[model samples]
Target: MATSWNGLSSVLPEESYMTLITALAFTVLWLLWSISSYFRCRNRLPLPPGNFGFPVIGQTVEHLLALRTADGIRQWMQKQVDKHGPVFRYRFVGYPMVMMSQPEGNKFIFQNEGLSNHIFWPSHISTMFGPHAVITQSGERHKLVRCHLNRFFDRAAMGRYIHGVNCNAIRHFTNHWQGKEQLVALDIINFFTGSCVCNLALSLEEGPLMYRILEETQTWIGGLYCLPINLPGFRYYKALKARGSIFKLLDGLMEQRRQMIAEDHVPEALQNDILNSLLTVPDEEGNLRQDSFIKDNLLILLFGGYDTSSVTLAMTIFYIAKNPHVYEQILQEQKLIVDGKCSSGENENALTMEDISAMKYTWGAIQETLRLHPVLTGSYRKTVTDLEYEGYHIPKGWLLNWNSQHSHYNPKYFKDPFKFDPSRWEKRPPPFTYLPFGGGVHLCLGYEFARMEMLIFIHHLVRNFSWSLVDPSYDGPIIRDPLPRTKDRVLINVKRVIAS
Candidate 1:
């Protein structure tokens, strides 16, 4: 085959041409060596059954490709599961790794965080979230950060958080949604989640700075889930640029927060936010948490709330339309909440913690959405020491991941697994079999926060308007803007409802 560089070689000086050829040769040789190393240790241990495909890239291309199709990851994983059972080995991005799809594997990874396994994040996640984030930390540091952050994130803080969330949802809908007859749901939902996280986590109101952060956040998310290749024209490069800008904005805010705490002049608006509390709140040792630690956790909340909430809620839009039964039931549930206010002569329509708590069927649909359309495919852990399970040997330092495909979609754990059945949530699935928010100490800190954000927005949505898909015939994979969304914009028509 003729090289694309055929004409370039003729124009180049002879010595330069030879040097270029040498460089190309060296690149090929290095890749060959790197790929060989992944196979060398395989013969030494009973590493689970799998193959290392291609050189350097390994199975990464396949993984990326599967992401483009609906139910692709689970489908791809199922093929390997059929051939290799619950435990299997595969290579991605030059790393030899193992993936498990059984509840046993999920339980083991969660329950043994510091012993058999330790937290590990892939390149894209760690880079985007930063090094000091608790999710990226392991051992004592992880516990330390978790303990400090828990004071603000635990159930006790819910009262302080919900009021702002409630206020924001009402304001957001009034300003952004009420007047529009048709709009892109992805853009609308992303804006709502991003703004809420920033306000609750950083005490920003609707303004230029908050909107700027939200804009950059949009850029950062584009690369969050893609392969971590950093070259130009790649999504990860643009994401890094976005992170730089967002951190600069956050750093300026943090300094102001630090000064406010020092002066002992906390504004009522800022008092409830996690930023104000983190800057002044003492830890178990009576020491204020470090700046980097606070910033990292805040970044985590931003990513966690925006990514997962947007995905689950977007899927909720899809599923509600696809399954009309769910929509009717959810609307029925929401209308009753509206009626409760009228009966009590409450003189207000804002959703409260009590109102959200009453959304049993709606929460069920949310759970069902999370199960079928998780923002993340799974979690990754690194072996702390050489380990053996199911009579297979795993040398220390091998990358391992636990995916929920087998457990979440298996007929044993969920009847007619592919079908969207919110009623199935009435009785919880077996332990460790359903973990959309994960579990153990490593569970997402924003779990409750995300839940509340979703409930409040959904409550407003179903109660205030009736919606229909602008393009009902379309069905395709949810594109990843660092999380699941429709490939084509999911536009919906809404006509505001007057209360009965």
Candidate 2:
């Protein structure tokens, strides 16, 4: 009986024992694979020094949170720069990135167009702008589109558009805020820019359709930096819907233009605006651009035109209002132009291209605003081949970012960098150090257009109104989604400057 019991105890189930051994073997194999993979990727060449915090997610949450406000972003970058020198490596939004804040780094990245291209935006941003848009295009296709668009923003073209820009500014002020006690500067400036761009780009009059377009564009802009999950309640999902709506609206508009052109309702020379130009411009094969290309490019222009220019205009107002001395100097500069017009028997309100050009001091003030509150914090480029910089090896297929704000606020580049001093611009900072409009082949094509719009608006604004911030204590925590904007939306008290 004892021998039989011992035999039973020794006969453990084969299936259970086999399962336990299999699990142990798999775990050991996984550990070995992970260890080898880690060792293989360890950089042989020294990378720009910085921490890649946490795995997978890797500094992305902190990076996005810092971008919620301008001060947060500045402080965050400053801290990293202090620790890691001007060039550093970090992981953010699923990319291994090297941030270059030094002027030499900026020059190398900007000048090496063949090695780097503007294809570094996340999935959500690329979807919003469309693959056909100029922002996403590279090489010969990019040059072709740029060449076509350049004709509309040249010196002669800007001279023609000045009247339209002036009219929009005057109408916005008069129709909306001439008698108002207080208004949100962001809202009004957005309206002003939307009106101006609509008229210039598509010849769309201020009406129900224009308002609809603006509404949809704002919704689309709100989603540019979203998480890109396509769930029902997600910001990116809503943005995708908004983009579809905009495409439909723009398609209808373009179709109408085509029909009008076919029936001879609109003449070729008379249709001199951007939409007309795009519709008529021929490709290398001498074929007219497709309607889809026209619509996509038009959307890019409209969003680009209104979003950046408006933010800069609003910040300029806030800065000027906060600093009495700055305001006084700007007022004096604008007044000189007004007075000169009055003396020359020119229309006091009508701003000509020559008149816009002569406002050098006014331009300085706008440039200063751009430097401090840059519309784009930074831009991204992707490496086509492995590159070396500052004794660091940046692998091919990695992303490189040149931070305009970091450079702008670097004490090494700008003395007393925090102070709002327009005078700094009178003597330009070193190249690539002050790239408010960006640099290289991908430099903003609408830069001149943006400058003219701001100048024209400032000319009208200072000449006619005296304003102050409603909340004097509100230093901006600028929220940058589609672009940088005030957290408070920039409320201000306004009174027309009655001519004595």
Candidate 3:
């Protein structure tokens, strides 16, 4: 074989070698042409400045590490913003994203509904809320859903639920924390807000059903920012399973509501809660909302109401606990309201819409907490048409994100942005500068409801109990994924406030 190969090599002419070289040159030229053509086609429209990071995974690992830290997602985003202006592009979990932290960018993305109408959610979030969720909808469907849901958060609705919200707050504090030496603020507030939402939305009582739903909802939300792998043990898989169980429970509840309506167990006037309203209310054509629609909106209500409200309440408590002067001011404001009620021969414990309105200082503290630790760090939107901003071209179909933390922390918007100052809110910041509940048409529909809940909770909380941080030396940053949560769950010590 060796001798045969040597003979063949010797017999191969110099012309044959020349032919091989020519073929190799042609192949190289073809490869170069293809590469240039691919780039030219893809770059017909210039993209925002960003690093694609590594292939496939992109910058997902960097993002995950940032989330594990105290500052969480905000720190990672700030670094990117510092390096690459307000509008910079990045890839995360295989999706191309353009993040905007400037007020102009936020206003452009939020107010220009015609150009940016799509809301993007992680698969786990979309699956958990289903297809008909108000947050997931856009255009006419979104407007329709928002109109229906708006009734539940209006002034009239807030007035009707004031008593229920007050009762839930008082009961949770008195029953759960009267004598406890230590309390996990997150756990307690979750139950408080969960119960409040259940009572207000479904007219449901506190029990295993509500508890199960809360548990499953948390499981699902916990995986919203997780990797999108779907294996059995993965977070996203577990979340999907949890979502299925939740939907099953919701289905049964919807069936019961239907049966009650059919049997006339619930009167027309009594059909005021969100579930009943969704089930019984009809469009101009008199067609009832589909059960899936009802269920998805219900899930949205739960998602919007429960975690954000609870985390806000918890942070409020932590801030009050940390700032003695602020706590005292809040206590004084709440005491004045209570004293006024007592002097007028009204029940001091009952919170009316009027009383909640009078809680100006307490509301300020809550707003400050929201500014420092927004429950939703940012929201995602997809461009519907190509847009240009600041000499950068944003092609259609690109993802856009406006971060609350960026606006909240920007010195241009708020002086001493990191300091906790409730008084700063006494004078309103510029439009789009304070976006804890978001801005523009797509602003959070439940903003009023959340504010009312927090205020009512604060009213009862300050009047009944005083709290202090469990570990004064422990200073950890907040975790923003799955909503803004304290690193230590805001552990605190509580004691009843003795009336003089």
Best by lDDT, which number? Answer: 2
Identify the runs in model 1 with alpha carbons over 4 angstroms from their true place.
1-45, 282-290, 347-350
Residue range 1-500, candidate 1, lDDT tens digits: 66568788878999999999999999999999988987876655577998888977789879877766547888899999999889998887677788878999888788888898888877777878888988898888888878767766666677667777877887888988888999788778877898888887887777889788888877887776677888988889988988888888989998887788778887877887788877777877899877777767787778787756876887798778778788889989888888888799874466677887899999999999888877766878889798887878888888888887678889999999888899998998899998888776788877877888899888878767777888887677666554667875578887898644
Ranking by TM-score: 2, 3, 1
The positional error of residue 370 in candidate 1, measured at the CA in angstroms, is: 0.8
Query: Cα lDDT for residue 189, model 2?
Result: 87
Worst 10 residues of 2 by lDDT: 1-10
In order, what lDDT does every prediction score?
0.81, 0.83, 0.81
TM-score of every model versus the real structure:
0.87, 0.89, 0.88
Q: Which scores higher on TM-score, 1 or 3?
A: 3
The stretch of ten residues in a row with the least summed lDDT in candidate 3 is: 1-10
Winner on lDDT (2 vs 3): 2
TM-score for candidate 3: 0.88
RMSD of 2: 7.6
Quality of model 1 by C-alpha lDDT: 0.81
> Which regions in candidate 3 have their CA more than 4 angstroms from the true location?
1-46, 122-124, 267-270
